[model samples]
Target: METDVLVVGAGPTGLALGIDLARRGVAALVVERAEALFPGSRGKGLQPRTMEVFDDLGVLDAIRTAGGLYPVGMLWQDGRRTGEYRMFDAVEPSEDAPYTEPWMVPQWRTQQILRARLEELGGKVAFGREVVGLDQDEGGVRARFASGEVVTARYAVAADGGRSTVRRLLGIGMTGEAVDPYPTLVADVRISGLDRDNWHIFPPGGAGDDYLAICPLPGTEDFQLVARFPEATAPDLSLEGVRKVVAARSHLAPESVTELRWASDFRPRAALADRFRSGRVFLAGDAAHVHSPAGGQGLNTSVQDAYNLGWKLGAVLRDGADAALLGSYDEERRPVAADMLGLSTRVHRGETRRGEATRQLGLGYRDSPLTRETRTHPGPLRAGDRAPDARVAGIRLFDAFRGPHWTLLALGDVEAPEPDGRTRLVRGPAPGTYGPGLYLVRPDGYVGWAGDTPAGLPDYLARFGRR
Candidate 1:
């Protein structure tokens, strides 16, 4: 058939994009190769910045209801409690940066929430449709699936996980080194006699080859089990095999793990794509970058990728913006993905702690070509910085920035342009937010352009087809 945008893969990335497109009144379609949503507890942590994103997407309430805060880590030795290990550096919330810690929700549960949101916004996923071949020109891209259905769209996005079929079809190459040599087994299993209040870790001793961790998944009856094997060894994924490993490493008996829901083996590696865009096709999520699952950056970064691209796509497709606006997606996201990959590797290798860097609240496109900083000297919040949360004149900055529209904050006598329906004008006193400047906030909650006056504001608005 035909659509404005074709989103391949129904994982968190594609579903989030579909929701964004749907709310923008764009005709988008999402296709998935699997018969149902992903069933696993992988990618279980949502970073703080991602929590803000979820808040904007209208899923934060459901997500918070379905998940809980990560519990403290309980170290175990010889079947006895030894000491407590804090998994992340403690940080209090601030008026500028909220969501100080990551939230715990199984990846499957997170996907379910996103899918429900997509459906609520008038979008649906086409399952059991595997994309076998793809061809794109200057106008649009055509996708042929295994079911003999050919679909055409103005643009296409690849969010089909690390082993992305679309990336392989486009001949995109991923380059990076293996982060760890030990094989890892991750599974969701039902267990007994373990308190659900803390994450239990059995460190490797002289007798054991490696370590095993059992983390109780919030809002579920299962605990996620992660075990490491010796170098060059392939860990078994069978139920009996996991039972043996758990009994050997932890204090719990084999029968304690009563049911095994899902399990998989993987080698932790970090890799980034050679390019995020190829002609009319774009890469997102694991299709573009692969992380070590440390610092919980992979899934969060993937969702942000969709968040970054969604508004641009809406602008070009529906708002009469220039096609060149799309180029900023790669210019802005690639470097952030590279930095996150490095951060995940460092966290995995014990070279760093889960401190401020892992929070990802500071990531921005300051160097992107789209960011225009026109001022004698900018203050703390400049062009390309994340628009911090604040309340000015009874108007919450985020509330004004919500939905698919840009916000121009005329703070403290800064001359601002008259906002129309598409552009929201929020005038307020300086809560010391931007130090008396006109801040142009993008739909994605980034400071796109900032100036002391409305001198170059018209030109900036014209770039996005805004009047």
Candidate 2:
């Protein structure tokens, strides 16, 4: 089989990338080694920025319907309620940032929604196609599957998890440190005595005692159980083992855990791949970076990785853009991944709180080579910053920025370039969110270039093959 791009792994990253490419009319295929989608609710927190990405990918409504807000933590001592513990700092939604808090959706459900959207846009996912061999040349990439099938594509992305076979085959190295020495067990199960309104917390009673947390999963009857064990001790993943841990840690009896839906074990470790690109192949998601699940940054950062690369790939394949545009993927995302890894480790060690930084709305590409800021003195909103949402001249900025097209906001008579096949020009009065200027928003919704006048704008557009 031949395709424009071959995406490995059907996790959130690959599925979201498929949706982005499909909307751009790029022919791409997502291949997964597993027979079906992931079944666990391990990465359940959808940070506010990811919600915006889902909105542009046309899955926000379904996501909102499938999940609910996180509840306050209810502390239990000796089987009696002690006091309420707030998990996150409360923040209200504003026009600039619509999603203020993280939404609770199971990772499995999130992947399902993304897959359905990909299919709706005429994309396909080939299951059980484990890649055993990969060879790339100046033109395209040829991959060999375990079933002896050969597929070639112009580019390939390794979105497979941390133990990525593709990254290993490419001989890429990862630099990281163990966030914690203790092993953790995470599972989805049905419990008998816990209320679904609050996240139940069981603190360690004394020395040598471990803590356990059982949070209710939204849109389902299962509660996610998390427990920590002693250093160098392995976590038991069996049903009986889960029951024993629950009985020992919390006041609940072993018989309270009625059913086990899924279970897994892992040590909290953070690692980042040495690099993100190798010849025609690029690493994304867990393949590029792995985090301690403390700040709920693993899945959110992975999805954003796909979002950053999708448009660059689309530009090179579907549009007449320079192949050099793909280089920015590494230049832009590697630093962000490194920063997030540190943040996750800090949050895991209790050195930081999941506050405004965890929201991820502050992330940007201000220093990216693709960002051009030509002005005497830039305002609060400059090139490479996220263009805030606003209503200008009866048109919503996000509504105008949606879809697989570049947007030019000609605010308050600022000189702007004319609309082209791939660029849409929106002229309106300058909203307070963005001062009066010509702001060129990338397809992925970052201010790529900003200027007071149209001078040098044509040259910047030429870099994206937009002339």
* True-structure RMSD, every candidate: 1.0, 0.9
Residue pairs with backbone overlap in model 1:
none
Q: Put down candidate 2 lDDT per residue, 70-164, tens digits, no spaces.
A: 99999998999999988898899888888989999999999999999999999989999999999999999999999999999999999999999
Candidate 1, residue 49: how far the Cα is off, in Å = 0.8
Q: Give a tens-digit lDDT track for model 1, residues 223-323.
A: 99999998877787888999999988888899988999999999999999999999888899999999998778999999999999999999999889999
Q: After superposition, how far is residue 23 of candidate 1 from its true place, in Å?
A: 0.7
lDDT to native, each model: 0.92, 0.93
**How does model 1 score by TM-score?**
0.99
What TM-score does each of the candidates earn? 0.99, 0.99
**How many backbone collisions does model 1 have?**
0
Give candidate 2 misplaced runs (Cα > 4 Å).
Answer: none
> Which segments of candidate 1 are over 4 A away from where they belong?
none
